[model samples]
Target: MLPARHRMRRSADFATAIRRGRRVARPTLVVHLVLVEGRDDPPLVGFVVSRAVGSAVVRNTVRRRLRHLMRERLAVLPPGSLLVVRALPSASKVSSADLARDLDAALEQATARPRHLQVGRSS
Candidate 1:
């Protein structure tokens, strides 16, 4: 479980990271997993639950489920990476098993590596 501050905080940060960060994205019926390497340990995982996905409570439910999944599975991920798991509209209608399967698939794709860069280079 990463601290709140280290998590992606702003829309701009989310947009920027997704736009520019090299990523491995995979889609499942329940969620969309987009991951990119980030800073050192306590690797952050962000959840995106836009209105297109669900109502407030529904969105929060998806976020909580995904967060729990991350907590349980983060150990399998490489250190110093950022993972963003976006809830698809279908997430609101899925069971935990469905979410878990989607998450597992996404996690597999996210963790596959091609050699990540250090946080800073070309200084």
Candidate 2:
């Protein structure tokens, strides 16, 4: 489970990340990342596992797996970052290892160029 400080909880935060952040998509997931300026807090992460993915049980399972995977990779993100991980319908069928790989790849692509990830700035 991700700790409280690292968990993103507000709707406004999600909106900002999804709309202004850099996006990277994989077969299983999509990552949105925004590096906020002047924020002294730790990076915040959020998940979006929708009904399109599965029923409650399956969605919860996928969300949990993603959470566990993100917890390990959180340190790789810069401080004051906002991250949103959205699970695609196919995510319900993949294994945890595959999900992790997809997550890693998406994150890698999203953060590949630091110059492209700054908030309110276009690459």
Candidate 3:
């Protein structure tokens, strides 16, 4: 489990992150990352497994898997970053390995560069 200080618990925080963050979409998940500048706190992570993903049992299972995976990958995020992972319905049917792969790829893309800026500009 993520430490209390590193968990995104407030609904407002989740909404802000989803609204302003960069999004990385995968077949089974959508990752939103918002970077908070000049803060000393560790990154905050949250998971959203909607009813559309599955029944209560399945949603909890997916949430648990995502939490475990995020714990392992927490170090990849910058300090003060907020990450919200929303599971797609396909997530309920995928294996843990597949989920991990998608998550890693999403994180890589989300943190690399702003997607919009990457489209037409050169450094």
Best-performing candidate as measured by TM-score: 2
Q: Per-residue CA lDDT of candidate 1, range 36-84, in tens?
A: 3454555556778789877788878878887777677877666555556
Residue 38, candidate 3: Cα error in Å is 2.0
By lDDT, the best candidate is 2
lDDT of each: 0.61, 0.87, 0.85
* Window of ten residues with lowest summed lDDT in model 2: 114-123
What does candidate 2's lDDT look like per residue over 50-97, in tens digits? Answer: 999999999999999999999999888888788999999999998888
TM-score of each: 0.72, 0.91, 0.90
lDDT of 3 by residue, 6-88 (tens): 79987876876798789999999999988766555788899999999999999999999999999999989887677899999
- CA RMSD for every model? 4.0, 3.6, 6.3
Error of 1 at 51 (Å): 0.4
Those runs of model 2 whose alpha carbons end farther than 4 Å from true positions after fitting are 114-123
Query: What are the runs in model 3 whose C-alpha is more than 4 Å off?
Result: 114-123
Question: TM-score for model 3?
Answer: 0.90
- True-vs-predicted CA distance for residue 27, candidate 1, Å: 5.3
